[model samples]
Structure formats: structure tokens, C-alpha cells
Target: MYESGEVAIPLKDRVFGRYLADDVKTTEGKVIMKNGEYISHEEIETIEKENITSVRIKSPITCGCVNGICAKAYGRDLAKGEPVNTGEAVGIIAAQSIGEPGTQLTMRTFHVGGVASSSAEKSNFESPSDGKIKIQNLRSVVNQAGSEIIINRTTELEIYDLNKKLVSTFRAPYGSTLLVKDKAEVKLNDLLLEWDPYTVPIVAEEIWHFRF
Candidate 1:
């Protein structure tokens, strides 16, 4: 269940610093008959003066300094007028005068990746041993026109140990499109495996070429 509170009146936009009591006064001056009993603001004022009962202020009053007192009175008046759903009514009024209404609020959730429980620095080491290997006959063609074209050929290789643990990963440099001859035996700690060759696949090779 929600709670209730005094309404906050905005004073920044008020044209005049003060609000007149006459502006907030009812059309009929405080006296009337209701259910065979005399009902009037005068009677209530009299009771208030005599200290017989508490005086309840009504809202929409244009009394002096409407910023603080008048605003609270307006909220109270609304609450009393609609006691069954005063919470929503008061909220609407408060949002209109004191805060922004109907604005979307957003929140983001993030998830961490990798093996470490906390953030860790990346390692520069590649393999446990050192060896020498070489690739040969590499060629690359670049097609740069308004339409799509193909240029380079490449292959993917993944080397792993007998235990199936990934030892190293390598990609051929751009422009040169043959087996990397000098890149072999570069201290690869595991077995050698190669993937099928990739043919020229799209245009813009000069702009989107792979480096390693």
C-alpha cells in the first residue's frame, strides 16, 4: 500500500510572489443548510475559534503564498474529495507541479566473461616450446569498386596437444594469400591441424583486410 503526504507546489513559475485569499474563497460565503443541519464555513470557523474541533482546510484556495500552504491545501482537498483513491490523485498532482511525469527509467545489467572470478590482466605468452616453420606461395588480390568483389584466399589452423587442449591459434596476414612458411615451428606446444581454404568472398579487401 502507498502512503500520503503534502503536495509540493511549484513557486518558480508563479507570476506573482503572493496569492490572494479572495482568489481561493468559495463562491458562497461559508454558510448553508445540509441534511436539516446548518452547514457553513462560519460555523466551522466558530468551532475552530472555540477550540471545539480541528479546522480542515480545503484546496484550490488562492490564498497568500500559494507556494507552500496553498499547495498542501490543494493536495489535502483532493485526497478528501476522493478518499477511495487519494493516493493516485495526490501522486498525479505532485508529479505535475513538483516533478516530471510519465518519464521512462532504464537500468542496465552486465555479465563478466573469461576464466577468472575477478578482472585479470591478459597474458602475452603463446606457447611452451620454440620451433621453426615456414609457409609458401601466398597471393592476395584486392577488388575495390562500387559493387561487391572478391580478392584474397586464406586458411584457418588450430593446433592442440594429445589431450585436446588448445595450444595456439593463427591467421595469415592480409595481402599475402599462401601458407605462412616462416611462421611454422614458432614454439607450438601441440599437434598441427589445418582447416579448408577460404576463397575470395567479398569486396573492399583493402579496407576490411585481416592483419594476422
Candidate 2:
């Protein structure tokens, strides 16, 4: 989901720089303003804080540039007395959604790593905390791998709400077909069956029950 927020501009620290002149070779770029037209980086120290305006935040994507220098570069131009274009001042919030199975798995693994690292950082030889941390780390590792094992063993699956209830389930037999909503139809193979709702418990014994 996309959300909008506001970012308060700091007037005192505005400094701008121009894009490399050699990079703008296209005819369309000829009309665009070049560097040195606005405030220089050194002039940022002179501006007062009250001169700032509210900037809109449309998306929450991570900036690849070092220390958000891209934003700072543009802010400097605004401060240095350049005319503003409608979209020119607005930042593109490139939100990324992790929808694919592989990406989801990777995120889960990353979360587990974080937990394991925290557990290790507090480890002490004499304290029982070390043993507890080891147990927690082991559990996270099993939980991560258990999902794949469940998917491999089960033909169908479903996810329920907060209450322990069955929302939906799919059944798989040899050559049986499963249709995902508006996506694709997949045929069941000997290895495993397809499922719905896609939120089944990742327990070894429970998964064993689904294995054919």
C-alpha cells in the first residue's frame, strides 16, 4: 500500500549541485537547467531555518545515493533561489513490495539472522541466558526451514484469521489441478500438492501427515 507523508525542509542546510554536464547529451536535456544556476553548497550555511517549506513524501523507498545526497542536491537549488517546477520538488517514493515466494523466504531468513545475532551478543558462559539464546536460535532455524518442508509435503493448504479456524484448503491428487486466483493453474506432481490461503503450520510432525 502507498501512503503519503510530509517532510519538513531545513532552510539553513540547503546546498545544491548540478548533474554532470557530459551525462546530458540528449536533445530533450538541452532545455533543462544546468549546474551553478542556484545556490552553491557553501551558501547553505547562510539560510535561516524559517525559510523551509513542507515537502510531500509519496513513497518510502530507500535512497541508493550516499547520505541522501540526491535530495540534498535538489534542496540546495530550491534554497539558492531557483524557480520550482510542479513535479521537480516532489520526490518519487519508490516503494517495493515483496510478493514473490523467494523474496518472502529471504526476508524471513534475514529476520531470523537478526534474532540470532541479538541472542549471541548477550551470551555469557556462566549464565543460563546462553543456553536460552541457543534454544531460541535453533527454533528460528527450524521454523525457517520447516516452511519449505511443509510446502513440499502438502498437496493443499489454507490460512485462517486470528482465531484458530480453517479458512480454506486445497486438495491434491495425481494429475489434479489447482487454480490460483486470477494467476495461473498448476498441476499437482508426485512431489507435493498445491494449497490455498497459503498459511499452514510449519511443524515437522504435522507436515509428515500431509506427505503422500
Candidate 3:
């Protein structure tokens, strides 16, 4: 619980019979569940449909004092509590403070002595919107191992709508393995690239013009 008498819990961890500390609303500002209402299984399903990841629930008073004494001391309801401000990113802030230090310490220990270590990196691109991919300036070469490897380093992946209007553009990180072919249609959450993120990132400052 935070100082404001509320705790943010992830949707998956939320328990029934707990009261809400604030109004739960949809992305368009329509209220799904009002403040101080007890969470029910039906409410949980409704929240899931809206894609809400977390919610603030009222924190029960645990001052460990005599029943009426604590209520009088705090000058608030013994059962219900004050609403926590939704503007505060309490969940994200707490996670960074608690998780970053451990992650940094673990990353440092990955490279002990002279051995190269694999660092965590994003190895794939998931499509954010529905569109067709348009690949440009792509160049590759076959290695002695008979594997095709991208070498241009400056190739671009552009997303276009059915009307041929460009919607978004992305540049593949150097040495990334391409997954989708040019003019391939894609939908949301579709995989676009399977990058070699475990290896040291290769950078090329100049654009290449290959003739093959």
C-alpha cells in the first residue's frame, strides 16, 4: 500500500472481495467500474476485455490499534479509504526501483574474465498495425557456411496501406535477419524480423550499392 491508502495490483493478481480505490474506465473515458465497488469475477472479465493491465484497490487500515481509535486518529472511514491518484505511475516506478539494480548486477557478472557474453536484446519486430511491408535497398551475401546474411546495413522496412500511402517506416538494426519478404501483407502482432540480438551489434555508417 502507498501513503494514500491504496495499492496497485496487476489484473492477473487481483483478488475478489477487494474494493476499488478509484473508478476504472475504458480508453475512451467510459467508466467500467465505479470507485469503492467490490471486485467480482464478472468485473474482472470486463476489465480484461478493455485490456487494462493494473488497477488500484483500497488499502484496508492496518494500524494495529483499537478498532475505533485508529479510525478517529486517521479521521477517515474504517472500512473505506481515500482514492489514490491515478496520474501516478506507481506500478512502473516501483518496478524500476526494485528490478533495475538486480538486472544491472546480473548483466555485469555476464562478462567475467576475457570471455564474450550474450546481452539481453530485442530479437524480433512485431507489427503494430495492419499493412503491407515494402523493403528497400536490401543487399545480402552468402558466407562460407552457405547462409545468407544481410550486409547493406541501411535497408529500410516501410509499411504501406492498401491505398499505397506510407503508414510507418523502420530501419533494421545492422546484421538483423529479415523475416518478411517485400510486399508481404501483415496484421497486428505479426513477426517481421528475427534479429541476431545475442551477437555484438554490427554498425555500418555508409549506404551500400551492391551490383549482383
Candidates ranked by lDDT: 3, 1, 2
- State each model's C-alpha RMSD to the native: 29.2, 21.6, 15.1
Report lDDT (Cα) of residue 77, candidate 3.
27
Candidate 1 stretches with Cα past 4 Å from truth are: 1-106, 113-128, 134-153, 157-212
lDDT for model 1: 0.34
Model 1 Cα lDDT, one tens digit per residue, 21-90:
2222233444321222222344445444543311223335533553444443333233354222323454
The whole-model lDDT of each prediction reads 0.34, 0.29, 0.62
For model 2, residues 57-93, the per-residue Cα lDDT tens digits are 2112423455433442343233446534434434432
lDDT of 3 by residue, 1-212 (tens): 11111123445454444667789988899998997676766777888889885677655363345432232223222234442333444446557787866786877754243422353346767776888999888886544554445676567788887777897766666566667788999998788765665575454435567799
Q: What's model 1's TM-score?
A: 0.19
Model 3 has an lDDT value of 0.62
- TM for every model, in the order presented, reads 0.19, 0.16, 0.35
lDDT for residue 91 in candidate 1, whole number 0-100 = 45
The candidate 1 region of ten consecutive residues with least summed lDDT is: 1-10
What is residue 188's positional error in candidate 1, in angstroms? 7.1
Q: How many backbone clashes can be found in candidate 3?
A: 0
